[model samples]
Target: MINFSLFVATVLIWGTTWIAIAWQIGPIGIVLSVFYRFALAFVVFIIGLAALGRLSLPSQWRFVVLQALCLFSFNFLCFYKATSLMPSGLVSVIFSLATIFNAINARLIFGERVQSRTVLAGIIGALGLVLLFWHDVTVSLDLDVVQGIGWAALGTMFFSLGNMMSRKNTAHGVTPVIANAWGMGIGALVLLGVASLSGADFILPNTQSYILALLYLSVIGSVVGFSTYLIMVARLGSDKAAYATVLFPIVALALSTIYEGYEWYGTSFAGLGLTILGNLVMFSRIKPA
Candidate 1:
């Protein structure tokens, strides 16, 4: 029952974040926006953990650093840029492939066995994404669209890698809240450094949309989203928890349709159906070998 609740919250919160991210896209640099989001989230996490007496640092700084790099910093850098170059929904769809990436990464890093069903699902989902983006890839000469797809793919892969680090921390008895508290703090610092080196503006945007979106992204999206999702990962395993990606994009696409005026055709709908079906296959119960 708890797992179910976490799953639902993860889907809803992250699903809406893509559009909120779109609101963040105007004058501010992507790195700075990401820094603001994580920086705010880091402060919230620190206060909450300190108040709860759970703010102790983890033993393995290396794992924490790995998690920071994969989850908090680089992935958002890629995702924010991706959203700028492509529709938020499309970025969500590409990011949904993290399930497969997680499975593969788990097999490699943790020696977790990958089921045949997972392989099959990957094939189906890959085909679906290809079909969904076929028109854009074939017809558009815009470099940004192509780069957006590449960024989304890289972000998803990094996200999967971060899940492995989370699993590692959990195995070493590090709680998700602690790992996230440190990870977000470290990640925020890293972003700040990058922004400084790159000469990006450190000033906040003067608009309400940017402020609200940053709040939403930090509090709900980063703090709540990462904490709940990583806890879910610890309990349910990364492969299972990542199924949220498959469903959340549906929510993102709906919002995109309404706000971004995303036009869809029969092919796109069919591709969505295939991707959902692929998720079903991937999650189907399998007997022990």
Candidate 2:
């Protein structure tokens, strides 16, 4: 039941965050917006943990630094940059490959065996993603689209690295909440330094929509979503937990259709069906042990 809840929460929160990111595109600097989101999240976690008397730092800072860099900071920097350069759905489709990346990384990093079912499910999900983004992929090669794919792929790989770090932290007996609190703090500081060095504007957005988006990204997306997802990673293993990415693009595309007027065709429905079926296959417990 806890795993189920985490899966649902992570999917719903992350899926909608794509739209919030879209809202965040104008005026404010991308790095600044990323900094603000994590800074706010860090503040919230610190206050919450202190209030609960659970504010101790990790015993080892190495994994925490890794977690901060990959998960809280760089991955999001890539993702927000990817979002600016590509359609949210296309970026999401590329991000969904984290499932495959996680499988490979888990095998290499932790000596975990990659199951055949997981590989098969990844193939199906990749096919579904291809169909879902068939229009974009088949279009005449634009430089921006190509660059967007590159950024998204990089971001997904960084995200997968963060997942491995999270799993390692958990194995070393760190709770997700405390780990995230420290990670967010370190990440926010890193972004602040980057923004300062780059001379990026630190000005907040003037619009209500952007402010609300930042708050939502900080509180719900970073705090709730990351904690739940890391919990799932600890519980289900990174290979299975990372399948949540497969579903994120589906929901993100659905939201895009409504907000961005993305036209859905027959192939879109077929892709959605295949993606869900792929998720089931990934999660199916009836396979041979």
Per lDDT, the best of the predicted structures is: 1
TM-score of every candidate relative to the true structure: 0.96, 0.92
Q: For candidate 1, what is the lDDT?
A: 0.90
* Residue pairs with backbone atoms closer than 3 Å in model 1 (clashes): none
> Which parts of model 1 have CA positions greater than 4 angstroms off?
286-289
lDDT of 1 by residue, 97-204 (tens): 888899899999988898888889889998888777777777666678899989999998899999999999998888888899899989999999999999986788
**Candidate 2's error at 244, in angstroms?**
3.1
Candidate achieving the largest TM-score: 1
What's the lDDT for all of these models? 0.90, 0.84
The list of candidate 2 runs beyond 4 A from truth reads: 140-142, 286-289
